[model samples]
Target: MRKEKRSSKVKDALGSLTQDLIDAGLGSPFTEKELNYYGINIPEIKNISPKKIKVIREKAQFSQSVFARLLNVSTASIKQWEQGTRNPNGATKVLLDLLDRYPHILDYRINKSKRKNYI
Candidate 1:
């Protein structure tokens, strides 16, 4: 629907989505049109090519190592995010999903209700 709308709810949904995807494979079993619905292209992330994760790093001009460090993860981790060999699980996936929709705002805070944030 809208950025605000997705932002407000997707975080909650993504954990389940991530689990479903882990169980099924890349959002396939989840039946979320947001991930993949053939005819209807969901507006925002439709253009962000799957592991357009590489694009995210490039657009931000971040070397994989640097971006990985920014995420408090290893360079290999960023490489995995780029290559799509391994899915970013737990909190990382949430961050990446947020990044996919709003690339520039990756570093912003999302779990505002939680205290003491990091990375």
Candidate 2:
């Protein structure tokens, strides 16, 4: 009898845990943000300013070449982005927008190169 009760308790706990997982996965309508990025709920960002993009790159203290390295894009591309001559596409746009908002997210990489200012 005790064993059956213990098993019932375990099953109840598991059922509750499963329901919690389903609820979190399905998203809560009452919650503020909608998009779940990686795992956490994040507010949606609609657009980015060309000026902020340029300032973000500049604030990283990395040259166009290094900044391009961070973005996995050509230096010419970064140049274009900074000059407002071209806009990033798809994933690059997402990445650039993130960098613009979270400039510190990329500061770690600048220290990696630590190359001479030969440029």
Candidate 2 clashes between residue pairs 3 or more apart in a chain or in different chains = none
Model 2 over residues 5-114: C-alpha lDDT tens digits?
99878766655554466567753333333223113344455545567777878876677887888888899987777677877777887787777667768766656565
Which ten residues in a row are the worst by lDDT in model 1? 38-47
Q: How would you encode candidate 1's per-residue C-alpha lDDT over 1-119 as one tens digit per residue?
A: 99999875765576556666655745444355644422222334222333577876777666787678767899987776667676566667666667656776755433447657575
Residue 66, candidate 2: Cα error in Å is 0.8
Q: Given candidate 1, what's the lDDT at residue 82?
A: 67
Q: What lDDT, from 0 to 1, does candidate 1 have? A: 0.62
* Every candidate's CA RMSD: 14.3, 9.7
Backbone clash tally for model 2? 0
User: Over all chains combined, what TM-score does candidate 2 have?
Assistant: 0.50
- lDDT of candidates 1 onward, in order: 0.62, 0.68
Top candidate (TM-score): 2
Q: How close is every model to the real structure, measured as TM-score? A: 0.43, 0.50
